[model samples]
Target: MGILNQAVQLAIMVGTIRTLSWPSANESRNANPPEKAVHRQIGSDFDYLMLTRIFPTAVCRADDDSVPDSCEIPTDTPEWSIHGLWPNFKNGSYPQFCDGSPRKFDSDLIKSIEGRLLRMWPNLYPAKTAHSFWKHEWEKHGTCSQNHKNLSSELLYFRTTMAIDTEYSVGSALERAGIIPRSEPYHLEDIRDGLMKELSHGMHVQLNCLTDKKTRQILLGDVRMCIDKSFQPIDCPRSNAFQPATYFTGHSAPLPSFKECPPLVTYLLETSTEPSHMLGLGHREFAYWINPLIPFYTGFFSQQKLKHELLWGITVPFMAVAIFIYVEGGRGG
Candidate 1:
C-alpha cells in the first residue's frame, strides 16, 4: 500500500510536468477548427499581438473594381496605415469574432481620439461609415485582447493601437532606409533589410503583396509586425497559412490576387500622375464580416494536432486513475 501511494504521487508529478513542458497546440499546430475556435478566457493562448499596417495606395489600387472612386488615399504624405491589430499565437492561428464577450463596440467610446483614428486608421473606402472599420477591428481582433489593462475596453484598445501606430510607422521606416514609392521595382530582400535597419531592436516584419492578375506584377501591400504581451516588438512567427480577409463583405468570387510578395516588388503610388507602367488591378473589400471565423494559419495545425490533443486529453485522466487505484489498494490492504 505504501508503495502504491508513492507511485500515485509520482504519476501526478510526472503528468503535471508533461502538461507544463508540452508545447501548446495554440503555439504549434494550425488553428483549431472554426467550430471549436471559441475565445478562451485570455490566458496563455496568445504569444503576442500583431500590428498589420497596409499601404493605402496599394489597397486603393486593388479596389478599382468594387468602388474605384471610394478608395481613400493619404494625400498629405504617402503612408502605410493600420489595417488591424490582431492577437496572434506563436504558430500564427488567431481567434476571430471571439465568443462570450458581452462588450459591444461603441464608436462613442473612442470619440476622444476619433480625429486621430480618422487620420491613422480610416476605412480605406469612404462609402462606409466613420466607425465601420473601427467597430470591425474591435469585435474581430480587439475583443480577444481585453485581458490586458491597456486594451481592456473598446476605447483603450483603439487608443492603445493609435499610440503604437504613432510609435511605429512602416512608411517612415522604409523612407529612412531610402525605400519610398517609386516606379522602379525593388529586390524583396532589400525591402526587408531596409525595414530592419530603420526599425531596429531586432525588429522583424512580414511583407505581403498585391498581385496584379493582368500583368502578374507584385505590388508591396502590407507589413505585419509582432509585439509581446507588454507591447514590445518581437520577431513574428513563420506560417504560410491563408490570412483572414480584411473586408466585411465575404471574400470576392474572383478574389484579388493578394498573396506573399515575390522576389521583386513594385512600390508605385496608386495616385501617381505618370501613366501606370503596369496594368491596373481590382480591389478586395476591407470591411468586417459579421462572423469572419476563418483561421489565418490553416495548414500549420494538421501536423501537430494529434500529438498535442492526445497528450493533453490523457494527462488529467491518467493522473486521476492513478490516484483512484492507490486509494482502492490501500483499502484492500
Candidate 2:
C-alpha cells in the first residue's frame, strides 16, 4: 500500500507539472502576432511656427489709419533755453547784430520730440536715454556752449542770406552724403516741413493701426517678418501616424492602441473653415490630446486583461489540485 501510494503521488506530481508546462493555443499564437494598427510617429514643426509667428502679425498691422500731410515745420527761429545750444551767449543777445547775441534752443523740447518718436516706433530704434543729445542743455558760461550756439547762428545766418535758387549748396552736401540727388532742387524749409508732416502722419497711422483690429494686419505682418527671420525651418513628420505605437504585452505582437491616434478626420470636418495659417495650431491641439499618458492607460488595461486571462487559465487546475489533495489525505488516513 505504501509503495502504491508513493507511485500515485509521483504520477500526480508529473501530471501537475505537465499541465502547468503546456502552453495554451492563444498564448502560442499571441507570442508572435502581426503588428497592431496603433503604431505611428509625431510631427510638430510646421504647427509650432504658425502659432508663434503668423497669427499675431496679421492682427497688428491691419488697424492703423493715420496718414501724414505736408505742413507743420517750425518757421520762426527757435528760442534757445539756458541749457540750449549756446547758453553762454548773452540772454536775447545777437552779437553779430548791433545788440544781437545768440540764444540756445531748449533741450527739453528736443527730448519731448524724441520721446514721442521712440514710443511710436519702439521696434525701429534703441531705447531712449535720459542723457541723449536731445536732453542736454547749453552751459551758460562754457566755451563749448558758446561755440555750439555760434555755429547754429552761423547756419541760420547763412541760410537767411542765401537766395532760394542758391539753396543748391545744401543739396550738394546732401548729395555727397548720398542722401538725396544733387540735381534735385533743395529747399531746406520745404524738406523740413515735409519731414514734419510725414512724421505726424506716420504716428497717426501707427496709433490707428494699433487700435483697429482690421488695420493692425500690416503691423502683424511686420512682426511676422521679424519672427521669420529669427526662426529657421526644420523638418518634421507630415502625418500623425509617423510615431510607433506602444505595446502593453512583453510579446512581440504589435497591437496599436486606437486611443493613441489623433482625431484628424473629425477635426478636419469640424474646422473646415480654419485658414491655412491656423491649420498647424489645430494639429497641435490634436497632438496634445494624444499625449503619452494615453498609451500608458491602454497598456495598463491590456496588462489587466492579460492577467485576467492567465488567472482564468489556471483556475481549473487550481481547483483540481485542491480536490486531489483532499482525496489523497483522506486515503492516507
Candidate 3:
C-alpha cells in the first residue's frame, strides 16, 4: 500500500512538473543575454555595507592575524591599532597628538605616541587620511632636536584647520551615504535595524524581477551559501512560521505538501475577500513562501545552525517531491 501510494504521489508530482515548461535553449538565451544586453544596477545596500563596513573591518583586521576576544584595548595600551597606527596618527607614521606640549621623539617614541593616540581617539581619522598624515609626519619628523623643528612642523601640519576640515568633509560623506554613520556613535541597534530593513527591501526587488527559473534558483542558492558561510552559530527556540505567497504564487505551488494542508492555503483563505485575489499572492502567503528562500528574511534566527535548519527543512521536502516525481515518471514510462 505504501509503495502504491508513493507511486501515485510520484506520478502526480511528475505530471505537475511536466506541465510547467522548462525554458528552451532559445528562451534561455533570450532570457539571459550578455551582460551588455541587460541593464542592471551595479550597486545595492549590501554592496554599500560591504564597502563601508565589512570590507574595511576585514582589511583592518587582516594586518593582525590574531582574533582578540574583545575589540577594546587594555587600559595600559592607551590605543588600539586597527590597520596601522593609532587613530590620531596617520598610517606608517609616528603619533604626535600629545597634550599642550609637543613631545619630540625618535621613530620608537613616535610609535608609542601613535599607540597612545589610537587608544584615546579610537577612530579619529579615516584609514586613508591617516596614511597621508603619517607620510607628512615622517618627512617632517625624520630630523629631531631640542629646538624640535621637525616636531614643530608635524604639530603645525596636524593643527592646521584645512586638514581638519577635509577629514570632517570626508567623514560626513561616509555618514550621509550610510557608511560610517559616526566615529563613536552609540546607536548600534539602530544601525543594524536600518541595514537589515534596507537589505530585505533590496533582496525582494531583485528576486521578484528575476523571471528565469534557473537563474533565480542559482541566485537563491548563492544567497543561501553566503548566509551559511558568513554567520556564526547560536542556540534558540524555533518557530514554525511560514509565508504563503512567495511559495504558492509561483511554479512551486502545485507540488504536494508535506503538511496535509500547507500554511499558505490557510493564509490565502483568510485574505480571499480582496478583489485582487489572483493578481498576486497575499502578503502573508508571499511572506510564507519567500521566507524559506530568503535567508535575510530570517533575521530573528541569527544563529548559523538555525539558519541551516530552516533552509534544509524547506529545501529537502521540495527536492524530495521533485526527485520522487522524476523517478516515478521513468518507471511508469
Choose the strongest candidate by TM-score. Answer: 1
- The 10 consecutive residues of candidate 1 with the worst lDDT sum are 281-290
Per-residue lDDT of model 1, residues 83-107, tens digit only: 7888876554666665424456777
Per-residue alpha-carbon lDDT of model 2 for 33-71, expressed as tens digits?
332111111110111110011111122112121222111
Q: Candidate 1: TM-score? A: 0.67
Prediction 3 TM-score vs. true: 0.19
Off by over 4 Å in 3: 1-56, 64-116, 119-137, 140-152, 161-169, 180-333
Residue lDDT tens for model 3, 1-333: 999999999999987765443333344235423221211111100101000111121112112212222111223321112211111111111112232223332333345345544443233223223334344333322222112222234333233222222332322332443644222322333332333343322121111011111111110100000111111111111221111111112222222112112111111111222111122233444445555855663454455457677867766886675445433332110
Can you rank all candidates by TM-score, best first? 1, 3, 2
Clashing pairs in 1: 29-301, 30-300, 30-301, 62-282, 62-283, 63-283, 247-286, 247-287, 248-287, 248-288
TM-score of each: 0.67, 0.13, 0.19
Indicate the residue-level lDDT of 301 in model 2. 56
Reference-based lDDT, residue 285, model 2? 42
- Cα deviation of 199 in candidate 2 (Å)? 27
